[model samples]
Target: MPRPPARPRLTILDVARDAGVSKTSVSRYFGPERSLLSESMRTRIEASISRLGFYPDRIASSLRGRRTGLIGMLVADMRNPFTVAMIHGAEQACRARGYSLVVCNTDSDDLLEQRHLDVLQGYNVEGLVVNTRGHSVAPLVARFEAGLPMVMVDRHLPGLACDMVGLDNAQAMHLAMTHLAEQGYRKVLMVTPPIPGISSREERTACFESEALLSGLESELFEVDLDNEPARLGERLAGWLDEAPACRGAILTGNGVVNLAVCQALHQLMPAPLERTGLLGIDELEWCALVGPGISTVEQPVGAMGEEAIIRLLTRIEGDAEAPVHRTFEATLNVRGSTARVD
Candidate 1:
């Protein structure tokens, strides 16, 4: 059978032939000079390429090509609504700039993050915006050292040295704590998500603790693993409710869903939840109003962060800046019925 004639190595020439266009036209159609083609012709070429699964030879193209005009976004957790919002923001900005975005979810794993980075790099993405979960920054440092364009989104490493775009987590947590303190809640308990040396969470939690200490307010920490048994979080909170102080206490939860778990546990543990304890949720909850007492929350400007990340990446890719640029936006504390003044 002659191995099916070696399967006729599919190339741009074959794609152009199948699409009824010159190979050079197809090449130019997919090139950085996209404005040279009409919308209809560009759409046709894209459709043809999609149908043929024709991947351009980046290695050979790189020798002579100017740019891939692509950007990669790496999210540590796609399920988190905040991350989703940020990505949506990035997608909008990327499209507006005539650059396509390739998104990868690492699920908060270093190995997975590294693998995605390698694959994206291999595909010759023009730049990267990453929300990393790992502490081992050697690989990323190597890439940045080799002059690959990169920007950190929502996560920071101490010495890895890269541009960062993130919410001001410390200031955000401090704002939440101050809100509770201002409401005259003597005892406050912060419900935190799992801290595995992830920069954002650690900074926010540390700031909350230190702020509470500085304010001379009584506070304690409780951690729940968000990756595992997210639903079972209610059960853990129920146990805390049983042992917590009876005197009017305010609880500050780290994430939106975690706030629901706390609310659920509060409902089960107390005949009247609000009278027993106050709640101030971190990150806005969709069902905050639907639930009784309407949870208060700190809303991170997730979309803004995403927009900033992509903008910084694009600027780097376009040779606007060679040095790292870091931007931190403060979170807004939205007061609600769940945690009111004690007067």
Candidate 2:
């Protein structure tokens, strides 16, 4: 005689029924706010859940739910290799903890960033790791203040406080500037993104300027919007080079994107019998070391930064968002042929 069909596998409701408690009580028992039930009741519910092999329907619960194991990452520009590497780090961390990541690109637009953030909230992501473009982040900050977890990477927002992981911008510049000076470069040009609002660029510019002044070396700044017109960089660089003819010196750039512009400018503006100009850049690029004169650089620990951002974001997700922490990895000054000593 065949045994009666096995009873349907137990679920949360079955566990609740066996434990003689409401489903809500069983949920409260397993959740953080565990004061709603007695120890005896909690134990009974736990035993029933274990014995019955019952698992909470996390997805459905998140639909009307509390704490979905999902995270949202907002990047200002997805094209940047540094940002892409950071995303890789975040993905590794998230996967390890059985969480999922949703990435959105805001293209440095405040409105787009806000819209993407709103969509994340609608999906009930447990946390957010953001690389905002310094737009209106007050609402996001307010949510963070009201207990939603957030961690910022790469760029810092003005007047908004959040846990952040990034490189020490000033230190990177100081190292690059000192390296250039040691190579006997008296006049230096710094190619950079727009300053004032862009924190990373601003910090780099400030440090370069201050260090140059301190060392009594004449330094010039050439700013460009690489994203808007990458090819137009040549024109801007040419103008800068034409104006500063005395500086047959090296050029230091803030990032890879700006470095491209600097190189293009050099290629276009230099008169026949091209002057041997030096080049240094922050944030290493794939082709940087391969080019002629091989770009000298202050290499940021991109992998480490990515890992740290995820680690910090997860920590905050686990109820540690209140205590603000800032971790900045030092940049390594890599001397290549670009900044070679002039005979």
Candidate 3:
């Protein structure tokens, strides 16, 4: 069989000729200065573009001394609901500002994060929002020094100073721990993934420990492997339940992943551990409500966080040159059956 003929690539000149307008007018209609064209001209250009199927080449426009109008986002783990929410919020904000977004997922790999950063830089994105495992900051710092506007979302580079937008993790910990305490959970166990270099997890774990002390609640921290070792987590939980004081204990998860792991472990236990111990988590999930005796959570303003990160990056890109601004959003507590007090 013969291959189909290639579609003709339309151009601005064709649209201008078809619309009976000057090339400048067509350019203005396609560029950011569309208001310069008269109403009739605008209508004619729109109709002509529709008829000709002409699409403006953003790359060519960038090459001609125009902004690429693209924002890049690097997410450590795309599967996380929080990252998805952040991307959604950032995309909306970028669209509203007449810019597009290019997202790169690192899958929690340091090498992948470095490569994604290089690729995004090659594209000359107007700005970047980074939510990644900040194990290495040298590359990021080099880019920032070279005048790349950036905002760190939910995690911060250790030595580099940049706009950071995320949940007030300390406040989130306080909310979760205090709620558990109010529910008569005297012994609290905080479960998290490894805290090697991620700032958010470390901050949350520290906050949990400090707040637990202040609240007079006996607390212990547990680090779980992300390789889906539910059996190990369950064994630890079972041991904690057997050793710790009776029905007065609860499990607090550092984030959504840990939350799911903890919940799964509890489900496998014989007596349905939810009936005996309180469970609460940070970063709410869609299934939180559907599970038996819904899981309580401190819901981060993920969408707002993402939007704020973009707004801050845009500001920096627009030449806001003051000290880096760090914005921390407050989390909302949603109480449910899992954290209910047991008499």
Candidate 4:
């Protein structure tokens, strides 16, 4: 199939000619000085605009030092429900504030993240909401130091002093550990994706380990590549079960993605692994309750967190000179069949 011919670009001069008015009149009609135009002249411009279907070019307007009313977001992975929910919250907040959000999903690719930063910069976005791996923080730091307003969600970069909104990691871990221990589980394994530069996972894993120690439970932390290491996870899980045959063991996932990966590995390793080992996760998913015996989760207020990120970003954009603030939201425990004691 061939592409359709491109239509000629409409210009302000065209609207002025069609309305039988000067280009300055058309400009004033769209500007704050629109009130100065006579009713008859305004009516003529309106009619011409309706007939021509002329939509003002925002980029051209922005080039003249007008605000684009745009906010940019860079996401680490769009596949995760957490990211999607956060994006939803940010988008709603943006709409409510008369600002447009431009989301660029990095797809967990470091190179794309770098490129997206440049693209968002070129557009002169008023602010940014970032949720991604912090391995390459130099660009973000440079931008932040250069006076670009920013807020981080779920993960905070180590050195960048930017506003951050996230769940209280210590409290969340205490909740997860307490529930498992109360359920009569003596041994727990913490599962997560690679946790080097991602601060959220790092905090969750650390807190889980600390909580396990304080609770006097035997614990081990493991990282798995969900894309290619389910079989390895199965092996580790099978070995873990054998390591403590008499005691009931549970798997504590660091986030929603890890929860899914753990389930996949368990299903492949045995007939029904949830019955053998308790399952709990740090993040909640819509389908969590639908799985066999329903997966329990520590639900983070992702939507609210996302909204708070936008709120904080807007404050910065609006000339809030206070220091970068960090806010942590409380997480709740949702008990389900997966975490129950089978015996």
Off by over 4 Å in 1: 1-64, 228-236, 242-245, 268-272
Per-prediction TM-score: 0.79, 0.78, 0.89, 0.84
User: What CA root-mean-square deviation does each model show from the true structure?
Assistant: 4.3, 7.7, 3.1, 5.4
Give Cα distance to truth, residue 290, candidate 2, Å.
1.0
Q: Name every residue pair that clashes in candidate 1.
A: none
Ranking by TM-score: 3, 4, 1, 2
Which scores greater on TM-score, model 1 or model 4?
Answer: 4
- Candidate closest to the true structure, highest TM-score: 3
Select the stronger candidate by lDDT from 1 and 4. Answer: 4
Model 2 TM-score (2 dp): 0.78
Candidate 3 residue runs with Cα over 4 Å from true position: 1-9, 16-48, 228-230, 243-247
lDDT of 2 by residue, 1-343 (tens): 9889887755667888989999888777645345667879889987888788887665577877476667889998898878888899888777655566899999888889888988988777788888867767688877777777788888777656778888898778778878877878787878778787777777778889999987667898877677676666676556555643355577788787777667666766654312466778888887878777577788998878877887887787676635578899899977788777864
1-343, model 4: which lDDT tens digit per residue?
9999999989989999999999999877765356678889989999999999997775777799976678999998998989999999989887766577899999888899999999998988878999988878999999999999999999889778999999999999999998888888898988889988888888888888899999888998889887766677778888865654467888888889878877877777777667678889878898899989899999999999989999999889889989889999999999999888645
* lDDT, model 1, position 286: 76
Overall lDDT per candidate, in order of appearance:
0.79, 0.77, 0.86, 0.87
Best of the candidates, lDDT: 4
Name the regions of candidate 4 deviating beyond 4 angstroms: 1-54, 243-245
Query: For candidate 2, which ten residues in a row score worst on lDDT?
Result: 267-276
